[model samples]
Target chain A: MSGLIKSSLARKVVMALSGLFLVVFLTQHFVINFTSVIAPETFNEWSHFMGYNPLVQFVLQPILIGGVVIHFIMGFVLEIQNKKARGIGYAKYNGGANAPWTSRNMIITGAVVLAFLGLHFYDFWVHEMDYKYVSGLAEDPTRYHEETVEKFAPFWRTVIYVISFVLLSMHLWHGFNSSFQTMGVNNKYSPAIKTITKLFSVIIPLGFIFIALYHHLNPITH
Target chain B: MKLFLKIWRQANANSKGKFTEYTLDGIEGDMSFLEMLDILNEDLIAKSEEPVEFDHDCREGICGMCSLQINGEPHGPDRGVTTCQLHMRRFSDGDTIVIEPFRAKAFPVIKDLIVDRSAFDRIQQAGGYVSVNTSGNTIDANAIPIEKENADNAFNAAACIGCGACVAACKNASAMLFTSAKVSQYALLPQGQVEATDRVMSMVKQMDLEGFGNCTNTGACEVECPKGISLENIARMNREYYAASIKG
Candidate 1:
């Protein structure tokens, strides 16, 4: 653990592992969200079930939240430590012909996503969880998760979701392959692994964005 | 050949700075990058505008003193060459070259394109040196029979001239390659093995104390490093740290 603490790569491994866990969770989350575009009724039911389900409330909630918390904390910590290890050299030289930009700015990208998540929760999760603080919603207890319909009702909201999803996708594009390398999985299959990871990164975020946009353009509930 | 130059000009670290443009009229393609800068400086002196202040001493590329980020690429469009060694042949006539100081929090802009890179010297002082005192060579040279491979690798690692180019080229401004090279130079040899654990720890600690960025392992430092230090040194440092952390 001391060695791990001292070494920059060890810190990176922690960040990558936690981040990979969150990426997997995000894909699962998009699967649940994408259902909104295909079948509103099923989506609403699923969303409602997710909110009130005892299993999720007791078990999955803590696990998912923990993963995100760990990923975020580890990321910032690694960034801080890495910054300390850096130099102040000037001039040019050879190399690094094949590095993606996102890989370099993961911390900045993460901070953006974290802020977006806070707003996202207030937009949907806070309302759906039916906390008593929502002043106008006390009168209508029956309309809770159905607020997702209202949430994506505006064109700008859909636009925001698309932009946020783009950032998320770009973040994952660098992050997925980085996680593999962090785990000491650098080898012949690294390229194939990176390609597949990028595809998943793009498709999953786009899936969420499509659903958000579809709901805004053609609402089934309204 | 002719190229427009937007050189960074500053009186000193405390002074205000700006980009001052100059067009070299009669430049030969064979003139080196620093030579082109000298021509511009001569013109600047002729105009009585303070000549562009850049850090350069041994134009031979060995001193690591000539540091500049030319045309957004360090050392200007070349792979694996110092600024002084960079030739004007890389640029075409009428090209507008944007010259700027190497950007990093640790590398404070001293004047023009030259920044204070003495932070590297400080980090090295923290533990980069071997502790053994040479009292007219206390030990015989042949006592330490380093494998030919290890000696060659150490030499490669030792070739780093403390130039800040690697830091400038990196987006995050990671200095892993630099730190690792210094660490690996000593870590690979038996003479350096005695204090390896302490050396790695202190150096890495001092590294964090200075504000720099993390290595994403994008390999940019290796690419831009004039010495072409391997990432293997970093791996070696990691192992050394891991072993030390566990033992000590």
Candidate 2:
């Protein structure tokens, strides 16, 4: 296991598992929010109901957070290890147009996504969870419904979300495919996986962007 | 052509290193980059001084031994060529050239510009090589008719000489490009598929243990690399790695 631990294959495995887990989380989160555009009232109720779900509130949130932590930690750790194995600069002779921006910028995009997570929690989760708990509205999340609207209502916040989601798209573009490869799944399924990776890279971020823009443009009146 | 060279000088890895200034006069502009260094060394030897210690073998550029940070850029400023391939004609007369050893935690200075690139070899040993030994011929070489595309890509991927310039040119010093190239070579070839997962996982792990920084995707590595290895190989490795993780 130690020998395996020291191998690149294992490190990639860690990256893939963690990354795919987060992708699943992102899709679920997106699907839940798509309800808002269908009908604002339903969206609000759904959001409120999601907050009150006992299993998700207690058991799942920790797991979701843990996924984020592990995905990011393993990525950076593997990157550092790769650097040490090479040198300050990699050999230029063999490298060509083969390198894409995202593969090189995984850390940058990941860092961007990480920072976005902080803002994300500060805006949505803080109000949806932390403030709800502090204001004695834990039993009723709708009391803080205005908080959710007010946060997304800011044009700048919406812009930040768009840019961050763009970064997230870039991250996911490389990460989605990379996750599959890292997990040793690059067989006949590679083509299908690559296609899905590209599609999700665009679709998921677009989903988030649409939600943010709709909220900002149509500022929900309390 | 006349030029000012701020070359790094050190007796050995344990000794203190510093930049020493030297001016060369009447050097032919057509001289290769290494020839310019040779001229400088000749001048120093005449003065009874130690010549700068840098790595070079088969200066024709196939050996992958020559490496230097010329004016803060690896292999000088020329794209798609090694330091040995660079010509003095690229520099104007009286230009100030700053020379430094390749800066990488994994590539510590052995003497002056010579770096210990043995880490790359160790990584290859971790799983870069084909598992099948060259004992009694395992059937004929053509027993397996690998697809032309895969064969070509494998050849392209195998072009990596293990020079450490990508690490130096990269902002974070990540070696994903190099490790990926090695992994993709085997991943693309049928002969390498048997050890593909193990090769990529082990090599990448060894790379991480070496104390280098993470990849930040500035494209500097791609831009400065002499052989022009594609960033696509990195993606291939990522894909290969993803598959390996699930199997394990």
Candidate 3:
């Protein structure tokens, strides 16, 4: 049992499973955020539920955080192990010959995504946490849309959000189908899976970028 | 043709290694890559210097013994051929070739271009064989009717010569292609069913214990393998391993 987790393939399995979980979470997060553009009232209601629901706050949020932490930690661990496996660096390595640039530079893209998450936590989650725990303020059930718009109203913050979504798209471009392949899902339907992953990679981030742009360009009127 | 060569020179596993340059002339375009090295070795012997030691046998590319990293490739610049099979016509006159040993923490340099590839032997010994009894009571070959595709895939997996090119080609020094080939060959055939679970588990465990890196699906192993092993075998191995884990 211990051997299963310690093996290299098993480590990859952990990475793939955790990555898939995060991808699902991203989809749900995107849907909720997208609601802000079409139906602000529904978006606020759902946001209040996610923010204050005991099950979501106490249970799902911790699991989501754990997934992010494990994915990041395992990625770095594998990268270090890979680096150490090649004690002597090659004088000339043609990495582009067999792999995409995104695949080869996963650690770089992943690190940038992690940095963006830090900003994301600071902007929204930290405020929510302080409001609930430290300030002990009564929850305003209607400020969800206003808060989101205010966060993106800053030009620098909007720019950062836009750039982070682009980087996230690049990361997903490789990571989406790669996680499936690692889980041994490569078969006759793999090409279809790859196509869907490509589309998802682009569309989801584009949706996020659109939300950010909409919020930034047209801030909510008081 | 005249050629300039920069080759790695290492004394032993623990010793520091560096590249030493040499020049040779009157080389024919039809000569093989190994033959070019042979000519240089003869010159070194005549000069009373220690001739560079490299591994080769059955120079026809079957032995899997000839290993060299030429111009940053496992079997030189040419695809689909071992170093012993690479002809000199691939290069032009006055060209300089850089050669080095296949580098990996699991494959330590013995001397010059030769590495200790006994790690592969150990991984194979872990579970790369069937446990059939040989007391003349074996079932007839025709008794088991396998699909043509299964037979072909098994044969393809069986074609792996344990050359370690897959390891040399991977940026992370992963042996996934080689290990998967072994696992797939057995998993695809009925005779390998009895110990399939144990075989996949033990072999994978041993492979990890050997200090090899993980596969990131780079696909360089397939591109660089002389035998043209496919990465599909890796997916198959993963499936087998997952099934085994669930059964356990």
Candidate 4:
């Protein structure tokens, strides 16, 4: 296992597997978040269950955090090593001539996504922790709807969320199918997988953007 | 055509390098890029000055001996050709061409436009082979039947010239394409089955030890390869490596 972890190929496999895990988490998170736009009651119930349920709070949430930490740490480690690989810089490297911006600039996109996660955790996770664990607030299933909507009421926050989503879209554009490639998935289904990943990259972020905008524009007036 | 050239110059591996500028006039469109360089060298030798040094052998694209990062692209602006095959017509009159050796931690600049690519040889030495007895006990290669697609792909993977263009073109200087091509060639053949697990594990271990960057799958290597080696070989190697690790 130590030998496996030491190999560059193994390191890449770790990145790919961790990244794919995050993608799965993102899809689930998107599904839950989208409910706030169309079904506030459903959103409140689901959010309440996730907040109070021992399985989610104690088990899955920690695993999710672990995934995020591993992904980012490994990303930084790989990026630094990769930089060292090109010991002397090229006087003029035309990287855009061959590869797409999305493929070549994953580090940039991934960094932005990491920054966005900081803000996201601050806005929601921190608040949830304070509300439930720190203050020891009594369970209120309906409170989730108002709390979520109010967080997006600020125009600046909404704009930041939207911009972050765009960068997240760019990250997924290369990362989604790339994970499959790293897993050594090359077969008859590859073309179909590529198409699906491309579509998902665009659509999921758009859905998140829509949720952010919808809450910002339709804040409760009472 | 007349061209202004910015060529890298260095005395030895331990010495510093810099771009030395030169101008050549009356270059014909039919002259290959290397031929133009030959004329410049002739002029320099006539003046009793040291001519620029670059690597080349066959002058044809077959031998991977030729390597040059011309005008920011490996093997010049033309696609699917080496510097020796790149023609002067690719550039216009008065165009400035920048020539530098392939840059990678694994490929140190030896002198001028020549880089020491013996790192590739070391990686090859690690496990890039099929172990077969030769003392009147070798099985006929034709005895094992391979699928048409697998055979074609193995042949394609075998075409990699070990020219470090994939490393030069990659932003990370990753040698995944070259290594993967080598792995895939043997991985697809029946003779390679016995040692497939060990071959992959050993080669990948050697590749990592060489200090080459990890592959990010940017696909630059595929685009810049003179032979147009496909990215599928990389995916195949990834699969092979993972399976090998699991087997171990």
Candidate 5:
């Protein structure tokens, strides 16, 4: 609603909800990507299904894209408004004394992650679109495994991917738990929730890094 | 103890400000931060120079009248104490202390080290209250029982003195903590339930209108708050506001 957009708290609720939605998507994406290293056949099968299925390609993909766009746009809106709130900057702001760097520098981490998203889309999404839509190629279920493995074959790409995942880790380190707080989730289980969010922030990014390295090291043999 | 002081000086709200440095000697460690400032003022008065202006009243921590960003921190790097309660002993001899007013667009500087905090009063006026009969027909205090934990939490939330330190401490100059404390103090009690829905809605709207930044859950406000107001108040306010929006 227009009224919701006008309220600062409502805007944050939008950020929290959209961010949580992306987290769900990230979890599923991580699971499927992990299968590429553990079970190539399973990865190919699932990737094929996701790529071709009308429900996923038509419905979920557009929604996922919308979520990403909304999150980033709202993030920028909030950042600009926040900057305006402090009309005059402090001469010496020792922000480190109270808040963590990850928490304070979310925009920096988020920008890095956004840049990585551009590269990630170019590497995979754009390629997939070109393959399926532009070129009108016949379906090759097994091609996914080889194609994914080969993408990481380049040392430079792998290094970039690894660095992006590190930045993503820092972004999630603050954001994942922060979403819950924004949603007003304070209770006896809050401590446990925080622990789980922290763990997920670390483990998921580490998992992605591991997958990237694994493929880079063990590219498909000729 | 001798110290170097860099204090922000401004002629008025419209005038540009700059930090003017002063060196003072023979200050006792037992003297409060304000006492040291008083000594500096005395020297400036004798020299026929403009004295550094700051806000202070009651000289006690409870008034919430004194505000100073000492050494880039609210209340001079002390925990759970206002500027008036901070002693010079916290600093080493020959230390350079930087004193500036709390900076926020919503809190404009009225003079050196005194920003207008009427923005908070406006937020409070928006709805930080509960309607009750005060016409000699008030309900009995013991008529209704409240849970002990809720009472304790409410009391803790009420500890906020509206010092604007949380605003000074937040990187974004967000007033979420201060506003949340006021909301929580009432939202926890039975009396507040009658207008709970309207209270949160209008207060939050007013807060946004005041041009305060949104909360990012950085927890800096909690760390720097002299009253030790918990971040739980903010979480509670978020819950309150969400519930109100849904109810509408």
Candidate 6:
């Protein structure tokens, strides 16, 4: 096990697996968020169940957090290793000659995504925690829709969410197909995978941005 | 044609290196890239200056002995050809060419335009070969019937000449293409079945231990490879490595 973790290929397999895990999490989160516009009661009910369930809060949430931490840390670890591998760079390196901008700037896009995650956690997760553990208003599940609308009501906050989603799109554009390649899934079906990944990368982030915009443009009247 | 050249100059592995500029005129379009360099060296020799040191043996693409990064592209702008095979016609008149040795932490500059690529040799030495019985009762290689596709794939993988261009072209200086080529070559063959698991594990371990970077799937190494080695080999190697880990 130790030997496997130490190998470069094995380490990459870890990154790919963790990345795929995050993608699934993102899809679930996006679907839940999208439900607020289509079916408010169902969205609120699902939110209530997730928030109040001890299994989800204690077991799954912690694992999700661990997954995020692992994915983020692995990105940094790989970036640092890659930088050190090239001791001295070419005086005139035309990286664009061979690779796409998103592929080459994965570390940069990843940093952008990380910063956005910080804002996301502060906006939703921290507020939930404070309401329950700190402020002692834990029993209120009725205000779930109102609270979500209120969060998106601020113009600057909406703008930030939109921009973050755009950056996330860029990050995923390279990441989705890259994870597949890393897992050694290249074959006749790979072109189809790349096409689907490209579509998902664009559409999912666009969906998130649309949800934020919908809430911002039509805040619930009290 | 006249060309301005900026060639990397280093005294040794530990010494500092920088690009030294030279001007060459009356270069013909028919001259190979290495031949142009030969003319420059001959001129330097007449002036009693040390000729720029670079590696080349066959002056053909087969040996993979010739290694140089010409104008930010490994083996020059043209694809699928080594430096020795690249012609002067690839560049227009008055073009400035930057020549440098393959740069990587694992491939330290030994001198002008020359890097010590024995790191590749070490990785190969780790587990690149199948341990075959040389006793009198050895089975004939032809008897073990391999599928046509696997046999072709093995032959393709075996085409790699251990040139360090893949390392030079990779943004992370990853040697995945080179290492994978070796791994896939043996892994696809029947003789290599006995040690497939151990070979993949040890080769990848040695690759990481040698200070090479991780593969990011940018596909630069495959694009820059002189032999046009496919990115599929890297995928195959990854699959083999994952299988080895799962079994253990």
**Ranked by lDDT, top first:** 5, 4, 3, 6, 2, 1
Instruction: Supply fnat for every model shown.
Output: 0.32, 0.26, 0.58, 0.76, 0.71, 0.71
lDDT tens digits by residue: candidate 4, B148-222: 988999999999999999999999999999999999999999988988998888888888888899999999999
lDDT of 3 by residue, B154-248 (tens): 99999988889899889889999999999999999999999999999989988988888989877788999999999889999999988887777
- Report the lDDT tens digits of candidate 1 across residue range B71-95: 7666667777898889888888898
TM-score, each model? 0.74, 0.74, 0.95, 0.98, 0.98, 0.96
How big is the positional error of residue A209 in model 4, measured in Å on the Cα after superposition? Answer: 0.7
Q: Write the per-residue lDDT of candidate 3 for residues A1-222, one digit (tens) a residue.
A: 555766898889988999999999999999999999999999999999999999999999999999999999999999999988888987766667666788778898899899999999999999999989999999899989888988988899989889989989988998888888888887898999999989999999999999999999988776
DockQ of each: 0.22, 0.20, 0.62, 0.79, 0.74, 0.74
Which is the leading candidate under lDDT?
5
Query: Which of 2 and 3 is the better model by DockQ?
Result: 3
Q: Is candidate 1 or candidate 3 better by DockQ?
A: 3
Per-residue C-alpha lDDT of model 1 across residues A1-222, encoded as one tens digit per residue: 574665565676667777888877887788777766666667777766776677986698888878888888877776665554433332332233435567666777788788788889788667656563455444442343366767888888788788888888888888887677555454568779878987998898888888777778776454
The segments of candidate 5 whose C-alpha lies over 4 angstroms from its true place after superposition are A1-3
Query: What lDDT is reached at residue A5 by model 6?
Result: 74
Please report, in order, the local distance difference test score of every candidate based on alpha carbons.
0.75, 0.77, 0.91, 0.91, 0.92, 0.90
Off by over 4 Å in 1: A1-17, A31-63, A66-112, A131-156, A179-193, A210-222, B42-53, B109-112, B129-159, B186-193, B216-219, B230-248
lDDT of 3 at A78: 95
| Clash tally, candidates in order | 13, 62, 0, 0, 0, 0
Error of 4 at B128 (Å): 0.9
Instruction: Tell me which of candidates 3 and 5 scores higher on lDDT.
Output: 5
